[model samples]
Target: MELMNGVFRPYADSFVIFFIDDILVYSRTEGDHVRHLRIVLQRFREEKLYIKFSKCEFWLNSVAFLGHVVSNEGIRVDPAKIVAVRGWMRPISPTKILSSMGLVGYYRRFVQSLSTIAAPLTRLTRQGVDFRESDGMIAFIEARLSLVKQIRSEAGFVCPRRAS
Candidate 1:
């Protein structure tokens, strides 16, 4: 892709860019790592490229690049996504409520007792009720968000034995 080539061609031998902007600089030795970083930084300056320092990580053996968290530990969902899940809010429309529930349900495996956890909210959906930020709704939202924060993994599928 032009975007990738434009941003990363200069660092090809020593590093690989993941997800377009997530750069993973690799080196065979510590000295090489330092040199590679310097070279890359220099190229960035030359290209007039700017990076968010807060999002930049260095000297990491493993890291979360893109959606999957990469590290020596292996790949998993990014913690920030987990945080986003944990802070999910109840949608205000029937369609949006269903959509939100569906999205979260897709990752149900990451949330323990998902069925039970979502029982209250699900009931409202079944009854064709519009979403509201009522106390119970708020509680359900908080619970789902907390569950998502606690677990960061792809959800398993739960097939409906009988179609509606």
Candidate 2:
């Protein structure tokens, strides 16, 4: 991954984002996109790395990278990834609680003060903490409900921009 970074260091963030073997080149215009794609491909050629044509997609208005979708509207958690939360059963153990937290934590940036919102659930995970039905169930339900509300709003990690 570090090697990938060095290979595209000059263009990182401006037009390209590379993770391991995946390279996503983005641009606001068709002409600029072509230029950006050329630069990225040229780098691959120079470095003797090969990209499989079958796995490549071009000229898309939106693309899924990692777990989120990047598009003109800004990044959002992929709906498919969150569908499981809709039917999630109440967690019964510390491990289950942690798993629930992990799911929400993945999109923590979209939910403000998630740590505070999930405090009770977090406490249930700590050693020597008694996992009472009242306390744990209330916290778990609250956290899950909060996440569902946020999902309904279609919120996720949207980068802030300064006023022009």
- Record all residue pairs in model 2 with backbone atoms less than 3 Å apart, i.e. clashing: none
Clashes of each: 2, 0
Question: What tens-digit string does per-residue lDDT give for candidate 1 at 6-64?
Answer: 76775673456545566777665689779888877887798788989998888887665
Question: What TM-score, over all chains together, does every model reach?
Answer: 0.45, 0.88
Which 10-residue window in model 1 sums to the lowest lDDT? 155-164
Q: Candidate 1: list runs displaced more than 4 Å.
A: 1-60, 63-66, 133-136, 152-164
Residue clash pairs of candidate 1 = 62-71, 86-145
Candidate 1 RMSD computed on C-alpha atoms after optimal superposition onto the true structure: 9.6
Query: Of the candidates shown, which would achieve the greatest TM-score relative to the real structure?
Result: 2
